[model samples]
Target: MSSAVLHRDTRFVPKKAIGGQGCYINLEDGTKFLDSTGGAAVSCLGHGNEKVNRMIKDQLDQLAYCHSAFFGTQVSEDLASFLTESTGGKLSKLFVVSSGSEAIEAALKLARQYFLELPTPQDQRTRFIARLPSYHGTTLGALGAGGHVLRRQPFEPLLAKNTSHVSPCYAYRGKKDRESDADYVARLATELDAEFQRVGPESVCAFIAEPVVGAALGCVPAVPGYFPAMKAVCERYGALFILDEIMSGMGRCGTLHAWEQEGVVPDIQTIGKGLGGGYAPVSGILINDSIVQAMDKGSGVFRHGQTYQGHPISCAAALAVQKTIKEDSLLENVRTMGAYLESQLRQTFENHPYVGDIRGKGLFWGVRITWAVWAETFTDLYMQLEFVKDRTTKEPFDPQDRLSFLIQEKGLQPEFAVSLYGSPGTVDGIRGDHVVLAPPYIVSKEEIDTIVNVMTRVLAEVFAELGV
Candidate 1:
């Protein structure tokens, strides 16, 4: 038999997900898997949401697609309005797109365009400064703006040199034991300032950062005062502060906009995943009033656009998702449930010998596993599993060991039947390993407990089996 699809790992064929409801996904072969991370934190409302599905169907029945350049749809306009208003009009204009990558692509272009639209056009401002352990997207432009080392390595030659990176605000590994939170923030701020100076501040367009570090670094939130410090540097350099809330925004971090908690407003922002709640492929860029006015007074046009830029059905679905979140007062639930999750995690993993750090906000949490410690703490388990070589000095197992991948896979076994989102290279973009969990905003306390219990069991079994 021949297959038309090209899988991520050709050797490992994945089971089909036939259906999903709430937090569980049913596989083709009848296995029910509780999704703890919502497939990279995309499914905020969880699978099979009736309201979202109905909205999609209603929109489809009315109208679906049209060229945005020639037509404006009510659903698209409403979603754009809702999103801009959600930011208290700080982000004055919205450009809807199909995915997070495209939203970021729009942001990159708009940043350059914003500079160009200035009274004294900053035509030389072409570069972007992002942070390491960052993942903006996979498209060439977005890829260049990201600093996920391993992902960028193979594509280095193909990627543009328009973006540079600084250290991410990862307190677990980046902060020193003797350093205070303020001092750590100051140090990271200094690093950003120096990078801007090194890159020639005058020529830079923006400093792009995830409000909360997402996949590349697990779910690391910046230390207090970090964003304000970073924003100060960008402002001093006349650079726009671009916050990538693609994974951590839209109530994922207990707030609609992650920056709200940081007490900073970005000049530009990109959001996805939770926006459409995995009901539709929708993402968008929200431009500040200043930038929008500059463009309005100047060329009155953004040079870039997509054919499916605000597809009617996509916007309708997203609008419904947002409405449901608001009407149900789910952000309150995120706060309530998020606190519960944090407590549960601390209770479960705080003293686990191999669990080095547990950090995050709201529902977005990361568990940093010290694999070397894993071999030491569970000598018998290590002997039975026997994947890594060294058990001391914090040395990671060989890349071939694929510890993170193995744990992700192992979480789905029959005994546990739970799912987790795992990523490697948390330490430097190639060595450290961590697991991220972003349960649905609607997750119940009972469900949260179940997720924790299932995850704990899965971890134990993975250590014993080296596979999920």
Candidate 2:
């Protein structure tokens, strides 16, 4: 039947998820599937978490909506304080928004405004340098700031021209065979410096990047010293360092913030997904004290405003999520379970011909599929299937195959009954496929075993179906 709501895929109607508990979701037909990806790693504590639900309800009962421009609510105030305190006062100001994309928009504007608010207004500093294959958000400003080729394709004509892209510090693809980690980082730093020089360093406002790349490039983390090197480049050019930790922060990377593990602090940080843990649509920007002081000394106000900037209910939900993470000691579980998950994945796919690389941090892992050459030339059924290879190298598969979709489809079958996050265009904007797995922090050893076992079956079935 025709529906009123427009779905992601208009051709197919999805099954209704009527119930969920812990790490499992039950459909209307009573089929339960393990939520291995936590709905794109948003449900950190998992579904039907009583603590978060209770807080949301309580906030609704007490005070649901209050425009930030008019009045301040305790819920929003407390949430902001909690977040700032969590950062040890490094990030002293919080700008609450409803989604990750909005947070990014705020960060971009704030960074630019910060320059303007300086004692000597840097009105010319209007550019941002982000890395390629990164996913920041889909909104116009955020999209302009992002470097995802496919995402930026149709909107190329309209996206802001001030933003340019540099190579991401992806070791798997960027590092040379003989290059040491330090040398690779140095090389990447040099490239970034060159980009700044080409774009005119004095005209740049910030260098935005994800601590651990999410959907756009799968869950790829930078090699050691990568962040410091990049940060050094930004500092050298007097540009703010903006970290898009929307997917990697909020304890998803075994720490409250993914940057903590890298020993670099971003001047402006955006966090979402697990911040509210699927309890509410909430995201925020954390601003450094220095930026805030600059603005305070100047116009004494940020030049941006949103009607629902500090939605009380969203803040309450996120507060509860953070409190739970702290009280239950979930980050410990994230580390323990993250190690177990990585080990299990390595053991299962280490010898699998189709599996090329498995890399991630904490609970977020990405399994990159083998390139087209391996799949077509080495696999048994190369001639039977319609293979689409990269025109230049004939290596990676063409994006037209929808390989990631097939893996996700097979994983959701009744036999496997699992949910895995699938992302494509891993090699440039039109090639490569990878599946990302981000289980909830509360996942158990047995649950990890189930996820890996089912994924193994899913991969085998998908490959067989594809005649590979």
Candidate 3:
């Protein structure tokens, strides 16, 4: 009856996801799964959005495909204007791309170009600094900037060597127990300063990060004063600040933009996932006036683009999605529902011995399983880390040893999926294992409760089986 290629654990065929509505994905087999992660936090407006679909249809009716160079479309500019307006108009330019990875690649290259835009001989700087356990994207350039050891393994040689990482603002595992948030933040900032010094500050072009550590740390929001400290350090080194909001922005968090909560703005910001609300594949980078002015003064051309750059229909869909969010005030909904989700998860999993942590902002949240469960399942992950020595040379069954894979499989069950929003958990600071949750902007209290209930059951089931 069906002959189409499929992926991801062929042992269990996923029911064909033919459609979606609000927080639920509909299958051709008449099954529905709650979209807790909003398809990797992309579907902010949820699915089957009549307004976005209408806009796409309207744009397609007028023009389907137009090369973005010679002819700039009204829809793209309008979408850009909306984004700039939403972001407080600090950003002057928006370069639309097709996906988050491409957006990140563009942002990285843009930072390099911006430095070259400097007229002085100091413009040759091409170095970038990021944090460990932070993921930028999947493409070579983005992955190069990303510090995830597991994702960077096979192509490690191909990645740009100019990019290096400092310690993430992660406090749970890395922060000393005795350290206050302020002191811990200062320590991280000091490390960053040292890195800048090590790299010879002038040679570094940008300091990049996911405002909230996503995917790599189970939605680990930085400790207090972290962003402000990092921002100050970046400015001290005269490096551009590039914040990746692809996963945490677009109202996945309670704030319309996660950076709004972070209390610092970036010279360049990349966003996706929620922008088009899964109605279309669209992601873009927002440029502050400084970067734009630098380009104007120097290399006037970004020299980077895609065939689908600022696709008219994609822009139209995103614009409509944005409009709907604004008109309906979905971000307010996110804040309200996010609080409810947090309370539900905390109530359900906080005391559970196996569920180690529950942390996030807005609707984007995560649950981490204890390291005790790691040794039993997903043990192969240990060998994947390049830095770790297989001390089968008399290694103990350390909980840390089993943490990564244990956290991953712990979330998967017959009912729901977490970490679908757009985060991976951290293990020994590298391998992915934590589960993230990113429900839609339109999620209800009932739906949030259901998600928590299902998640609790999954954690219980996994832990009980492990005898934890």
lDDT of each: 0.82, 0.84, 0.73
Better of 1 and 3 by TM-score: 1
lDDT of 2 by residue, 1-468 (tens): 677778998987788899999999998878898998989889899999998899999999999898888899998889999999999989998899999999999999999999999888999999999988788999989999888888889998998898999989876567787999899999989999999999999999999999888888777788889999999999998999999999989998888988998999999999999999988899999999999999999999888889888899899999999999999999999888888887777777655666666778888887777642221111000001112233223255557668888988888778888987887878786677888888899999999899988887887777777776
Superposed Cα RMSD, model 3: 5.9
Which structure among the candidates has the greatest lDDT? Answer: 2
TM-score of each: 0.94, 0.95, 0.89
User: Which has the higher lDDT value, candidate number 2 or candidate number 3?
Assistant: 2
Off by over 4 Å in 2: 371-394
Question: RMSD in angstroms, all models?
Answer: 4.7, 4.9, 5.9
- Among all windows of 10 consecutive residues in model 2, the one with the lowest summed lDDT is 376-385
lDDT measured at residue 130 in model 1 versus the true structure, 0 to 100: 92
Clashing pairs in 3: 40-421, 42-273, 215-423, 215-424, 254-362, 374-402, 419-436, 425-434
